[model samples]
Target chain A: MIPYAELLGLSVEPGETAPTYVMPFAVDVIGRPGFLHGGAIGGLLEMAAVGALKQALADEGAVRIKPINLTVDYMRGGRDKPTRARGTVTRLGTRVANVEAVAWQDEPDRPIAAARMNYLIVR
Target chain B: MSDSETPAGRAFDPRRLFGGRFGGHGGRLGIVYHDHGEDWAELALPYHPDLIGDPASGVLASGPILALMDMATSVGVWLKLDAFKGHATLDLRIDYLRPARPGRTVIGRGECYRITRSIAFVRGQAHDGDPNDPLAHVAGTFMAVEGYW
Candidate 1:
């Protein structure tokens, strides 16, 4: 299995309401001139959402889950700097769980991106 | 356009750009350059069967297309900005028009509609054929950085 650090290049942090993940934006992740590549942001969001789901499962005394699909909406241009993402579990059913997350740089009010993802929970 | 002119004014050759080996998904998916005077750009794809997903069904795989659109839109911005440093994607919304045709190559062409000091906006489409009816449509925004790359 690929280490989480290698997969996402970030460490996962646990919290009460949600879990947070931090990723540093660098020149390698840049796309055009001054913008962060959309794919990189998508990867970051996916990792954060998945990490949150994993943590939530552990909290509920459950095990075995995998990502099924993820859909992201871009709200604003992401700046070239470190980014923080927080994920919340909106719903947790027996077979499936729904998650929502928002990623931002310095401004929380103005999010760089938002995403809703679904995971399949195994028994 | 003359033989001495840059290749931008001429039609794009996909084989030359996407052909040969690549390091990984990131390298293959990275957007290199667009045909200078044209709307199309060269996007690479690392060798990964997972990216092909359903081979029998011939789906071009959403993950790679997502990467392709991301790169295409960024190049669209670079075309307009002339000289850009770094930018972040503010938003990227893609509407899958249909299942991509299988066994054939995929190409993306994007156009920058507007830009400002802080943000650059773009819209583009991806297709295997017939640009008029694309396999996917994407609209996104990128934030400009303070320096150049």
Candidate 2:
């Protein structure tokens, strides 16, 4: 189990194509008064991105991945609800991988937050 | 969350806001108040195994650092406003310069450079031991729910 995910009470549900990361609204994730913390949302998105990267690298036996950078855009304030995130690997190269993730509370079309990330992969 | 609290012109104390043992995620991650000024604030994130992103390296995850910086910059905005106006993070971008060394505390400092009627712009950096050698650089904005003075 990922320590940070466990800490946030984040769960991963395996889907047919990719895994979806879910973060429940709890006292540990509150930012202002009732909304979710941006960093918590960012963490869930990062976990989703990493999950997608791992799925993309299933063929490789053992590989290490390190995060290089991330840009998160908060479109809407996260209300007191379960937020779900999914990552899509845009470009997976030999040494670098680019991933994008979106997080939504109710509707998939209406994303509350989105992020693009770059990771360094050591084969 | 308005200019009401600014009536007395008392400064917003982030340390007081983060009082007690539990402050949600910030407290759970052991983020403590380090220092603050008029428009800048610094926070400390102690090393803990629970925050390790890579178990083999035992290095802290980028997420926790992001959280620290977020709170730091949020405090910076409040400090700059000199009031506790409610605000939400609009956007944030982080560049990881290097992974933090294992078993080391990280210090994150944030500064609010600009504040408009409804938005605040901030930038910050995180360092493990030395302020000169930073591990992460961050830039972001916050949207004041109430008008910012």
Candidate 3:
């Protein structure tokens, strides 16, 4: 888990390609009675995206990461259950990286939310 | 909502709901209601060590700022609609203009620009001390599940 990820109570679930990040339903993550807060889901997606990006760039040596921007789309209201998220590096360049991530509960294919992020990679 | 639903039936007071207190993610991030108006709301994020992203830089993470704007905009929608109906964020976009300075409280202000029967359009800005030099800018939409009456 990343340093900031711990503040959000996020954990990693090992997978074949990239690990899935899990955020349990708790008071810190809830909004609107039983629904998950949009920001929490957004944070989870970011952690997952960064985790995946780090793995993808492991062979490239040390690099400093800075978030350029983020866009999130909420499809379904996340219920009172643990949410899982994973990211895919859409494009990894020398100076920048584009990543897409999805968060879901129950299944991976049916995502509750999705996020697209651009990060500046300083080497 | 039924056409018969009156404004009095759904009247909302953001001040009462947020009044210097925060629960859920807002509380976790130490966000507090800063100020509000007829169609806008402001939230404050105090500096904390745990909220730091890059240890060497001592700057706060973008996630907390995003949360602040999200809640602020949600409140703005309520203020604009003049009601507390069930609405979900359909989409939100944030552009980081610069990193926030450490130990300074970041203030996020959200404004509801327009509204329809099903959606509310919003835009906002976040700044540490100076509004002219903002740290981030945001635009988003919220869908009313109960339908904006």
What tens-digit string does per-residue lDDT give for candidate 3 at B14-47? 7578655778888888988787777888889999
The DockQ-derived docking category for candidate 3 is: medium
B-chain TM-score of model 1:
0.72
For residues B23-83, write the lDDT of model 2, one tens digit per residue: 7788788988788878988888999999988877788878999999998999999888877
Q: What is the interface RMSD of each candidate, in Å?
A: 5.8, 0.8, 1.3
Misplaced by over 4 Å in model 2 are B1-10, B20-22
Q: Which candidate is the best by DockQ?
A: 2
Clashing pairs in 2: none
lDDT, candidate 1, A1-123, per-residue tens: 223234335656777866788877665455444666566667677667767777777766647665555667877666767888888889999999998888899976778888887777887
Candidate 1 regions with alpha-carbon error over 4 angstroms = A1-8, A59-62, B1-42, B48-65, B72-149
* Maximum-TM-score candidate: 2
* Candidate number with greatest lDDT: 2
**Candidate 2 lDDT score at position B98:** 95
| Residue A103 in model 3: lDDT | 95
TM-score of each: 0.56, 0.93, 0.92
Per-residue lDDT of candidate 3, residues A53-77 (tens digit): 8888887788888888999999999
Q: What level of docking quality does candidate 2 show?
A: medium
The superposed Cα distance between candidate 1 and the true structure at residue B64, in angstroms, equals 7.0
